[model samples]
Target chain A: MSLILARIDDRLIHGQVTVGWSRILQPDQIVLCNDTIAADPWQSKIYKSAVPPDIDVSILNKESAAVFLNNLPLECKTILLVENPEDMFDLVRRGVKIDEVNAGGMHHSNSKYEMFEYVYVNRTDIAYLRRILNSGIPVNAQSVPGVKIHTIDKLALDAIESIMP
Target chain B: MINGLVVTHGELGVELVSVVEMIMGPVSGLTGRSNSGKSVSELADEIKELISSDNDCDTILFIDDFGGSCANAAQLAGAAGSSTRILTGVNLAMLLDFVTWRETMPIDELPRRLVEKGRQAITSMGPVQEG
Candidate 1:
């Protein structure tokens, strides 16, 4: 398994992920682990085409991805993509030894607590990822490359709590 | 005429414009959102107006994403004719070459340009395979 980078982003795949992230990491294979995207072929095609043509992309569900991660091929650098904490938790439960987890594009939304001006992590997501961190996985938040790192624990819980209704 | 439209969601369009201009010289189009930011649908309608206002013979609108509001709006606004192409995933290289070369070549040659420019932007950075 050439899985070097693992990221959790609700957008799954978009401009920031494809254009910005792809240029930095140059990951040959981008695997998006989301049940919804895997089930919908058309959605998969749309995301697949968004990525630079040279890079291969797979939209896999939780179970299949668990198996894929276990027996990852020894080849080019691969990036494991996920939409939320639940997916990450699922992988952890299935024994995906991801040392680091990146949080990207978790924009402001209803029911989400504001951790930063542009970032809002839901309580459930925070708790779940915290568990992963407590279990020994390091969860870091850097919207894009070359920005100051936002450690999951150091994330502004006060700011988030203030935004909660 | 191999015309193209660049529809940006946020300030990202500004960067796209620079990239496109670097490759294509000067061009005209719409950037989909205002600072206050209305819905993607609203932005699409405005872009539709911009394209329709030009009345160009052959146009290709490059939406940021196939699933984005601008791209969807382009589809909804109905630029489905053969002469008009709706492309998703607009990149700096694609915009630059497509716009710059379209002036010298016929619209029929656009497909080749898109492929060439797209391929040029890709650089393999990981482990190489042994044959």
Candidate 2:
């Protein structure tokens, strides 16, 4: 597949993606899709610097990312990254064919409830995640390679039921 | 004073800080962080918090290995820019040079100096020929 992995991590490009997943998937390129970060030159530079020089890095907004993913060469093994479920949903809606989605890291905040040790979500996040799961994409949370992958569907369902008004 | 933070796997960061302090005599604003049981985001958050705590001082993150978790976390912290710098392949000599010259040396120049010191400390140490 052109797209080897699609991950939703608030910290888009980091050790987990660069070292953990890269070692396992060994993708030819990493594509980071975020409007804000793509616009900021400094943030783009920081993300690019995190990855080794051997692999290609693309920092593109959602629309550009959709075009890039659609026409990606079959030989190109690309790992797609978005900061949140909303962005992931947007990409899916934009016709980016993804087999599975990895909810890598959301982190804890006052507004977010813990789904896993590393994954956190709130009502709005759950809503976006539900939409993504409803679209028939499997979402799993695994912080690093060689760890148990927690299916996020059940957790999202449970979280949705708990926070119901 | 420019702050220094050493990040590594296991107890290396903590031990490095302790050893440096033992030699330098209780230097302030220099600390260490470990990536044990912590995700990249968690470690990045900690680094960001430490940097934010000392907003006035320019902070330098010394990572034990390049392309490792510590270096990745430092990059994710988004603290690499004008005020904050991330230096990989950290060693005792670099930390020592950092502690010695941080107060007086310009922040931009200190990274190069520390790297030079670290590189200079490594040698073949082979038996010398009798002269």
The residue pairs that clash in candidate 2, if any, are: none
Worst 10 residues of 2 chain A by lDDT: A156-165
Worst 10 residues of 1 chain B by lDDT: B27-36
- lDDT of candidate 1 over B78-109, digit per residue (tens): 76556666766777767756754666676566
Q: How much does each candidate deviate at the interface, measured as C-alpha RMSD after superposition? A: 12.6, 19.9
Give the poorly placed runs of model 1, Cα more than 4 Å off.
A154-165, B1-131
Collision count of model 1: 1
The true-versus-predicted C-alpha distance at residue A125 of model 2, in Å, is 0.9
The Cα error of candidate 1 at residue B23, in Å, is: 19
lDDT at A8, model 2: 93
Off by over 4 Å in 2: A154-156, A160-165, B1-10, B13-131
- The collision pairs in model 1 are A1-A72
Chain A TM-scores of all predicted models: 0.89, 0.95
